[model samples]
Target: MDARRDAAEDGRETIGISWSSPTRPARRDRRQRPCAVDPVMEIEIVHLDRRHAGLRIADPARLAHLVGSLARHGQQSPVLLVKVEDRTVLVDGYLRVTALTDLGRDLVDAVVLDHVDEVGALLLRHRLQARRSTALEDGWLLIELLEVHHRTQADLATVLQKSTSWVSRRLALARALPALVQEAVRVGSMPPHAAMKFLVPLARANAADCEAVVVALGHQRVTTREIERLYLAWRRGDPEQRARIISNPRLFLKVEAELEVPPVAPDETSALVDDLEGVAGLCRRARKRLRTGVLERASASERAPVAAAWRETREALRTLAARMDAEEFDGRPRDTHRDPAAGQRRPQPSPDREDVEGVTEHRQEDPRGANTRGPTLRSGIEAPAPSDADP
Candidate 1:
């Protein structure tokens, strides 16, 4: 349908949208003008008042796509306008106005909401594009309304259909952000979410370092994951490492990526043997530690997760033992001396074996009331017979 068409014959109403709370204020409280049906109108680009233009952080890629789309398909949506004094203020569609200007067009299709103010329009998000605002964007708006525009938190909470706690958190986030980081976010040089998650805490910790990092990332196309990795490393790094990261974060990310790419193994057998040996080494170390009663000194809460992990590992070892003894794995002839069912290995007979012909006498007893096995007790892992995977 044409934007300029008469809506009386069709019985069309207003924008036809509502928000979180369906029960709105009395019509006197709202700027809801009577819809004499409705007609979308065209406004000149020069007449737009962009006072709230910087409220949204413009994304470069999104703006470029919008420019291309406007060129190929003309304007499919209208920019929203609110009247202020003698000037017509743009309440929404900053990107559209920008895109049209980039295309060298002077006129833009727009809708004028009668008697609506900037605050009302922002609260309603009065536009066709249902784009959700990020938390950082919310912080910007909340700060402006409270400190500069003189709006109270309670009043905003009522209008936004949110609690006062939510408003306070947004204000805190905005307060902690450094000025330079804010500029980076506004111009699309830095991702808003990355700033919110990683940079905010960083600024609180060391504002100078955060500023340096933001400057380092100004023109780079680094992702949120990469930023997170950088932030984590910076937290764990020493002063010198942190300085190097601040100087060239992109290079650090590249180096980290290279380190994760493993060297090609000679063969699958070699890789398998390496993994088995690693597991065996860990188990032997664990047994040595357990003999020292490491678990005996810890509280139950601290030991719960460790106990659960140990139970899972023990069950896996049992399954491995059963599979090792199966004929399909060991092949036809079974080895005669591989019994670990009694938690002991059978060593081959040698001439160096000690003679035990005449040493027996009265045995000693420990405090736990169990008889000692011998004068000396061995304390080490029993090396199991190698599995068939050794080949």
Candidate 2:
């Protein structure tokens, strides 16, 4: 059956339909008929009367596409609006109103709801229609509904046609994430899930560190795995490790190596081999001392410089290791001739018991200024001090 014929047969008149002429302003039909089931009191109103107060974010491409569709085929659905004093605030169909305005249509079809407040309007919009809203947007809306409007999660679930758990999650996300992180998600700097995965845990554990990392790495294009790795490292690493990661992320991220080894001649290779051996021996002695708890007894002032140097050396080793791994994967040999520590002399050995006793006697005699030699170790063993003219 035709719509008009069916309406007539049901003893009701379709008084909502109206038209505007180019020569004159459009007016609403005065004839009003009551609808039984879906009673939508649609009328023609000025496009300017509508005001958007919903949760949908503005998207230009979507609006442009909507405008094209509306221009080809006029607005098929009426936007829901609620009367506020003399103004009509939009409850839904924001895209339609925007499209109508772009097409220079002075009049738009609207269903003017009666006595609905802002909260009611939002609830009605959610209940009557389904729209795509970002998680951040959902969070903001959920916050407003709960905090500003004093609505409960159950109420939100009922109104938005979502589960109670869904509403709870949205509310929690809104409350837990900082405004900056929310803004990052809203501004498309990162995905919502990624922010929840990467930023939330850090922010919960240490907000300052999270903020620092965000400011440092937010602009960089990092993958989810990289972000997770960085988060884990920042959360558990020592001061030096954290500082190194923050200062030189490219190294941890496996970008370009800071130091490159160039091909070396046979003579340079011999020197490089000796330098590597010296470093290995130094590391062995340091490990032995650490195992013996020697550093644990050191004063803070003495340990500070040692810790700093250790961190620096650790970063250098990491960079070198990454470079070696990359070269190995590419089936290329690294050049050992261009060693970073090239030409530097091997460390002098530590003083023996006799030499130490002599140094102690000298210090006792001249406490003001004693020219005592510093100690060193070789391959987990203490060595005697070198003579001044040994070189």
Alpha carbon lDDT of each predicted model: 0.67, 0.57
lDDT by residue for model 2 over 202-258, one digit each (tens)?
Answer: 788777666666566665545676777777777788988887777656467674233
TM-score of each: 0.59, 0.43
lDDT of 2: 0.57
Give the lDDT of residue 17 in candidate 1.
Answer: 22
TM-score of 1: 0.59
Candidate 1 residue spans exceeding 4 A from truth: 1-39, 126-129, 261-391
* Ten contiguous residues with the weakest lDDT in model 2: 354-363
**What ranges in model 2 sit over 4 Å off?**
1-54, 57-78, 85-87, 95-110, 132-136, 157-166, 215-233, 240-391
Which candidate wins on lDDT? 1
In TM-score terms, which candidate is top? Answer: 1
**How far is 295's C-alpha from truth in model 1 (Å)?**
41
Error of 2 at 278 (Å): 50
lDDT (tens digit, per residue) of candidate 1 on 23-126: 44212213444322124678999989998777788777667777776686677556667777898888767887888999999998777877566677666662
